[model samples]
Target: MEKPWTKSVTLALEGPGKYVTISNTTEASWAMIEDWPLDDAPALNRALDICAAAVEGKRPAEDARKAFIEAAVEADIEIRE
Candidate 1:
């Protein structure tokens, strides 16, 4: 099983005030695969790979978090601090 991150990544979706918080590798993986608005992107693919590695204990959760943020930016999604 995957462990939760030190801090959650909050992002705003398409609509105003709508938000989703991804707190772990699993949630990040799901969001990228299912909830992401873009069909395909380099950053998205990198995030998916990083998330998978993190879940398998091959990479740090922080790496996944950074990759997720990059993917969100590539998709033009708004990330909240």
Candidate 2:
């Protein structure tokens, strides 16, 4: 079976690599924003990969969130004040 939210995820690379946005276009839409730092590209890629795996049922959503959070921490992306 297919995952409902799989189709809602989109990737937007901005301004010749100024930033990246991974958005969920569903009714309960949400997004993950990553600013350009070049080095952070791998972290973003890792998070996206985890999300894809979760959508495919190869991984759990909680695991995905953990991976994403770790990526953000490794990238030093200040997501909260």
Candidate 3:
């Protein structure tokens, strides 16, 4: 017997000032979103929204990636993953 393949989304926001990362990958890791600052609201919300749209199949992964990059650029935030 073999294990079935599965996918999942991992959202994590570390210490203050760190840009939240939304990693879409196989079910290999799990994380929780917590301790986010109020100032990071807009960008964080947008990221979550984009992730939601992508997971729901409302948008292609590439399109979502582009959107994420665009939003990050607009906010002057650097994406590391």
Candidate 4:
């Protein structure tokens, strides 16, 4: 963990989804985006869109987060186990 800035960031990928976590002081939260089949993973697309928007300053990070949560609920993706 040479990069102190990345200490609070967590990125994980699973068979069912991709995860992105960011925070400060080593405390963070994760957003899980469900990964449906490549041919029809609407959730993943929306998730990526939100991610891009949030990073690009096109949308508020919280709004982007809401989008992901909504998508996850719609897809019935299990985020927290």
Candidate 5:
């Protein structure tokens, strides 16, 4: 029951040149669990939980999106507008 966010979040995955666009809870979760560079962090854990909740239909996808952004910031990842 994964849900898509109203807007997508773009992150610079391999520095400023490369990027990944996450548009839904599932993508966010995958990015956090599989592609994230940091081993662990408070914001990363929070984002994982929120993404799970969003996929389970217990929370809005936008919540997961916000959490993902926070996690990205915590990991020193660049967020593109």
Candidate 6:
């Protein structure tokens, strides 16, 4: 099934590194904002890997969120002040 929001999301996250603006209108999706490193470092790779894994259904969304949150914290990126 094609998802409109997902298409929007692909466009939103199209760059190698960019700000993530998440907004969910469905039960399985939620909103978040993440600033990614433009250097294409390990952190960025990890973030993209996690997102791709989640989107491909290789991992659950909650799990992906947890991974991303952990990564963000490790990277010293403050979220949800």
* Candidate 2 minimal-lDDT segment of 10 residues: 22-31
Question: How many residue pairs clash in model 5?
Answer: 0
All models, RMSD in angstroms: 1.3, 7.5, 7.2, 7.4, 1.3, 8.3
> Candidate 2, 65: how far from true, in Å?
0.4
lDDT of 3 at 39: 35
Say which prediction, candidate 1 or candidate 4, comes out ahead on TM-score: 1
- Please provide, for model 6 over 1-81, each residue's C-alpha lDDT reduced to its tens digit, 9 standing for 90 to 100: 423233222212334344454422221233223334343445545655666677777765655555555555555554442
Question: Which lDDT value does model 4 have at 77?
Answer: 51
Would you list the rank order by lDDT, best first? Answer: 1, 5, 2, 4, 6, 3
What are the lDDT scores of the predictions, listed in order?
A: 0.89, 0.47, 0.42, 0.46, 0.87, 0.44
C-alpha TM-score for every candidate: 0.91, 0.47, 0.40, 0.44, 0.91, 0.46
Residue 48 of model 3, lDDT score: 53
- Candidate 3 vs. true structure, TM-score: 0.40
Q: Which candidate would rank higher by TM-score, 4 or 6?
A: 6
- Cα miss at 61, model 4 (Å)? 0.2
Instruction: Please give the lDDT score at residue 45 for candidate 5.
Output: 96
Question: Which residues of candidate 6, in runs, are more than 4 Å off?
Answer: 1-34, 38-43
Q: Write the per-residue lDDT of candidate 5 for residues 1-81, one digit (tens) a residue.
A: 444689999999766769989888888888888889997899999999998887787888888899999999999999989
Clashes within 3 Å, all models in order: 0, 0, 0, 0, 0, 0
lDDT of 2 by residue, 1-81 (tens): 333433222222233324433323111112334343344367666766776777666876665665565565565554431
Candidate 3's C-alpha runs over 4 A off are 1-22, 25-48, 79-81
